[model samples]
Target: MAKVLMKGNEAIGEAAVLAGCRYYFGYPITPQSELPAYLAKRLPEVDGVFVQAESEVAAINMVYGAGSAGARVMTSSSSPGISLKQEGISYIAGAEVPCLIVNVMRGGPGLGNIAPAQSDYWQSTRGGGHGDYRTIVLAPNSVQEMADMTITGFDLSDRFRNPVLLLSDGVLGQMMEPVNLPEPNDYDINSKKWALGYRGNDKNERNLCSSIFLDNDELEEHNWHLYQKYQVITDLFSKGEYKDFAVEEHLCDDAEIILVGYGIISRILKTVVEKCRKRGIKAGLIRPKVLWPFPTAVFERLAKTASQFLVVEMSCGQMVEDVKLSVDGKKPVFFFGRTGGTVPSDFEILNEVDKLVRPD
Candidate 1:
């Protein structure tokens, strides 16, 4: 299997095709338009369907319809676009429909900039819209992971009967790298017993997909069921079932200071870790690949050993809150961030680490 040089967004599009995604409904947005563009052209080649819906809200509803019909469906957008789709996302989660959503994050409180940012961390992990539901969020730090996670996301979506989010950013969306794309996955749409279009004649019941459980008690029961499923996912990641893609613990064994980050910032933190080692500072890194079930166990395990934790992000500070929660004040949690499209350099971060280690 030979690797191909491709941009992150394009790689995601191709990976979805390989994952047997035959339906895509999304609106174009900066830093991620390439994904839709690639799919618009490539999906047809594979006899797939691609629709550039009029708006993000409409696009997500379209995804819901297709997913309910047992199709491997997907959608892509940036920060603001994802915001508009939140209500529909919540509905999908509540209805227990399976689909893949890609959010190529950009600077934003209100369409801030086309620059890369991780401001959506809270929204992605905290169930952005109404209701008490969760979407499995996967943060990829590289172009290769971008492709790999897209494939993994679809599989997870189906396995859990829930939506899966590939939380990327502008940097990863636009960057180009060589990716060894996975072989095409063979999926049976009719095998979804819960879906409306099952082919097996043995099925005698009608499958209805709807988030509206009018009765309060019925909704409560549904919510509790969703909670149990989420717990199962959290347990799996904590137990290292998906450790390879859940989190990356680099040089944290005996490190006194640990750095925490995800997405592209993790790549920078890795470099800072190397530089810290050269300076004789025991610095480690915790990169969460699965952001929703956030791999908090790693932070909990390291808090007793590591002196302090420094969380780096592209936003002013979002993920740091999660780190603090994970560490539970057992160790100090510090944060360093640059917003408005400004990416922090390795030198800037190493200096922060120096201050933490050699406080004046």
Candidate 2:
């Protein structure tokens, strides 16, 4: 119908239903509690199922079970709760089950405060659980992207038969904005010939979903098969969704400095880049909508002309390492971060940018 104002968490919850999610299992946690809370009330209106599990561990297994049975399922939690779901997430990944997991990160190492933080960058992009598996991760910087990414997350997860993560921080989770919601998707989930119960009786075509291969050589073979699928997924879901690799940049043709940020942090950097440029400084901002694929092409392209790189995040420099890896010694990379519920303000970001451009 029409665009409407929505909170980020609520937008994601609503987007899941439109994306054809019928099962949602999650426990409540700060910064993201609204996600499950909204789903619990909104899902049934669409004839969907929402369960507030006893714990984060239980919630993820519930998602695993639903996904295995060929249902569009999802789960969400804050930082610590997300950690508790790692085992279940890895299990779902190994079993080749399609599901969605959302992390609205708060400050952490333990029970850190309730404000926004991107400290979970490494936890999300890296293998958080035991195994040689990878999960596709989408980082949304606004309430609208949060909603859009939720729909895309389910599609990618089902297409790859792997878990997809919508990674947001407390700011993006709690803020409000206007969004044009997507039309409800009528998915053909049962079309998967390999789904658990959809396989019509055939001795040769039994659907067996498991990660364990007792024999070493058999396990190696299975791993190789999974790796091949991952490459295909990288080509299909990741690159396909992000045709330009979803890297947003500005004023980079002659930019001497590159300021990289994502999620809510990038929102601030957008203005900083403009203001810096107005003051005769060639500063550009680069942001990634999909963090797992890491969008290295943007860095490689800018390396030819950019002299310095600066990464600003709410976390204590987790994504900076990725920036360095992307640059590959082509340029000097620096980082500015504020943790434990603190956000990098426009002034601070500008000051950091000035440090990189100033003469010694």
The lDDT of each candidate is 0.93, 0.88
Please write out the lDDT profile of model 2 over residues 242-281, one tens digit for every residue: 6564678877888899889999988899899999989899
List model 1 lDDT by residue over 1-360, tens digit each.
Answer: 698899999999999999999999999999899999999999999889999999999999999999999999999999999999999999999999999999999999997999999999999999999989999999998899988999999989999999999999999999999999888998878878889866564747678899998899998999999999999988887784686668999999999999999999999999999999999999999999999898888999999899999999998888898899899989999999999998899999999999999998
Predicted candidate 2: what Cα RMSD to the true structure? Answer: 1.5
C-alpha lDDT of residue 327 in model 1: 95
Task: Flag clash pairs in model 1.
Answer: none
Off by over 4 Å in 2: 201-205, 236-241
| Model 2, C-alpha of 144: deviation from truth (Å) | 0.5
Worst 10 residues of 2 by lDDT: 236-245
